[model samples]
Target: MGFLLNNRVGHLLIAIMLFVAVVAVLLLIAKVADGLRGKARMPAVIAVFAGPALLMLAVGLIYPFIRTVWMSFMDARSQNFIGFDNYVTALTADASVIAFRNTFLWVILTPLLSTTIGLVYAVLIDQSRLEKAAKALLFLPMAISFVGAGIIWRFVYDYKGAGQDQIGVINALLNSVGLAPVRFLQDAPGNTIFLILVLVWIEAGFAMVILSAAIKAVPVDIIEAARLDGANSWELFRNITVPSIRPSLVVVLTTISIATLKIFDITRTMTGAQFDTQVLANQMYDQSFVFGNNGLGSAMAVFIFLLVVPLVVFNVRQMAKNREVRG
Candidate 1:
């Protein structure tokens, strides 16, 4: 059994057997449901379908969340109750303080910059001759995984000491212009800004795609009516286009904000959370896994969850309000 579990062919066979077992059980459930009376049949069928899903959710999501919250109040070894000490350390520790500051910078800058750039680009290319090509070109970066994008940009920002042959595109350009190469990843404060730019670049395409659809969905008749009323370009956009797509704007902004808040890949791949570029997610991972400080890590996780809940709640409320307005 151990050998079978370790072998590739055995793994495939085991997966196939599990799949077959699940199908047989589902079939048996359906047969039993069919034999039952009206009320019993409906309830049994519902239970057959929903029971596994609910069980999985309880085990996978709810249990882990509860465990993490419980651990957040315990000591590093989870052997003793430490109360709010871990939370205090997470908030007040020098590394954690820098992590929080950098996370704030990411949350603020990535969403706004990506959305603004995407909105402008979408507007500029809407109904244009090369709209498809232009959008495809802009969106190509989005196809790359965050790690891949980080590696690509690492080359773009790579630096070497003075009087050395520069291989990085940005540094090479600088060298060509008689300017010294800048250590974009190694520099503090500003390195965080450069890292934020990578996320913006990758997310801008997503923002443009969403906002473009929203812009196109605006009522053409309303646009014509506004134009006939002597509304100029800026007026039409400000009073018409912006208001019409406000819900989409909210969605794009909040979605990107949530994603930015949970940022891990770019920081991990590009800088390894070094040079004060650590965000909450990376810090949580390092504390819990690398340093074996589960208490502090869980505290960071809970703090992130707290920060995210408000954004998610706001987004849902806006979506519901939009639905009511449309209805």
Candidate 2:
């Protein structure tokens, strides 16, 4: 099995066989279902189709979640029940405190700044002749992976000592003006802000695309009616445009908030979670894989899960409310 997995041709053959076997099993189930009558056939088919999916879900998501929660209460080696000690360490330890604070900053600032910038951009470019081209320029960053964006921005914020030739864009500009070069990623607290800026630059494009569609979907008839009633641009935007796109705004905020909560790549890529810039996900990775402290890692994972649940629930409820209003 190891040799087959190691060989590319053998691996491809195994994958092809697995795919063929799954198709064959489904076809066999269909053929068997055809032999049964209506009432029996429907349920038999449903069971056949849903059983594998439910089993996979249980093995993949449900089992790991339960295991992680259980491990959160165990000793580092999983040989003893520590019972809340790991949670205490995760929540109150100095490093954990800093991670939590940085995560809090990320959750608060990234969504608000990204959404606001995107919405303003969307409104400005709405129905303009250069709208498509302008939006394409902004949204291009969305195509870049988080790690790629971090690498790109690292060059932008790169630092060298005074009187040295600077390669970083920001430092180079500072040098041209005789301003001293600053260490953007080495400074504490402020370094976290610079890391968050990378995520914002990437997510703003996503926010713009969603909010732009929402703005354009606002009824033209409603806008004309408001204009006829002597509503100025600001009044129309504040009263009509915003309300019309409230659901999209909620979605963009919550989606970005969730993404921000799980942010790992930017921190790991640029600073390796150094210089007081670690967030929950980065902390979790460090504890689990780097430090080999499973209990504390699981505790951090559980904490992040707790924070994300409310945002996900609110997003779902808001979407349902929007659907009902549309219905």
Candidate 3:
């Protein structure tokens, strides 16, 4: 088995297997398409089938993830042999430490702010006449990609010197209010907050949609009973609404947390990891491609994988628990 998996013959055999798999899928799809043309509405049913899509997923996503993990343990050029020295350097190195700190701060802030704002919006918008419109407006930001959002916000944070025409929204407003035009993305703490606001703006909508659905899924009978028992709005929400949607809350938290851990685009686009706004993912890109320090980059990648895996597992377990509860 080892010989089969390790040699040139093994590579050739794997390629052959993959080729056969693709041909078989294409043949099956062609047959399905032909059969569907003879029967109206059956095509829709066939479209929903995910077997072929899963094969693509296995090759595209799962394979690459496994390959990255393997490479993390290997040497810089992905040849030669090295042990845990990369991991050790990642933990203790100056650049890595800075990246780790920034990522930790993002992890702490992003999920909390996004989830809190989303939950509040969800609660307020539930069953309201303006629910659809409010959700549409809030969720509009989610439609924008990270790069687009960063570009938009770049103007928002644009700094101008004394008495010059302030092009940035923030500086314009500050000047109008008789306040100094603050450098929003120049300072350390300020730049971090500015970047965080972009993420919160994008992710809050996701949180709101998921949480709103969860809120609606709360049993009406339970809410009515609580109200009838003289429970106030807060009490009813706490006792009846929140507990019912606790699982969705957990899911949203973990999802946002995972997203936060992999936050690269905003930092990369807005700050270029400058002004001490660097996070783990951006640092990994910089170390690997920009700086050509593959060892450090792989270490950062491994660290991100480690951080995300536990949260993902926890989310899965929470989902299973929810399923069991429902059952």
Best by lDDT: 1
Please give, for residues 1-327, the per-residue lDDT of candidate 1 as tens digits. 877657978778898998798778878898899899977899779868986798779989999999999999999999999899999999999999999999999999999999999999999999999999999988889999999999999999988888999999999999999999999999899999999999999999999999999999999999999999999988988999999999999999999999999999999999999999999999999999999999999999999999999999999998898789779
Worst 10 residues of 3 by lDDT: 41-50
The best candidate by TM-score is 2
Reference-based lDDT, each prediction: 0.94, 0.93, 0.87
Residue 50 CA error for candidate 1 (Å)? 1.8
Which scores greater on lDDT, model 1 or model 3? 1
lDDT of 2 by residue, 192-256 (tens): 88988899899999999999999888989999999999999999999999999999999999999
Q: Which is better, 1 or 3, measured by TM-score? A: 1
Candidate RMSDs in order = 2.6, 2.5, 8.4
The digit string of per-residue lDDT tens for model 3 on 180-256 reads 89888889877998899899999999999999998988888888888889999899778888888889999999999
Q: After superposition, how far is residue 274 of candidate 2 from its true place, in Å?
A: 0.8
> In terms of lDDT, which candidate is stronger, 1 or 2?
1
Question: What is the overall TM-score of model 1 with all chains considered together?
Answer: 0.91
In candidate 3, the residue pairs with backbone N, CA or C atoms under 3 Å apart (3 or more residues apart, or in different chains) clash, namely: none
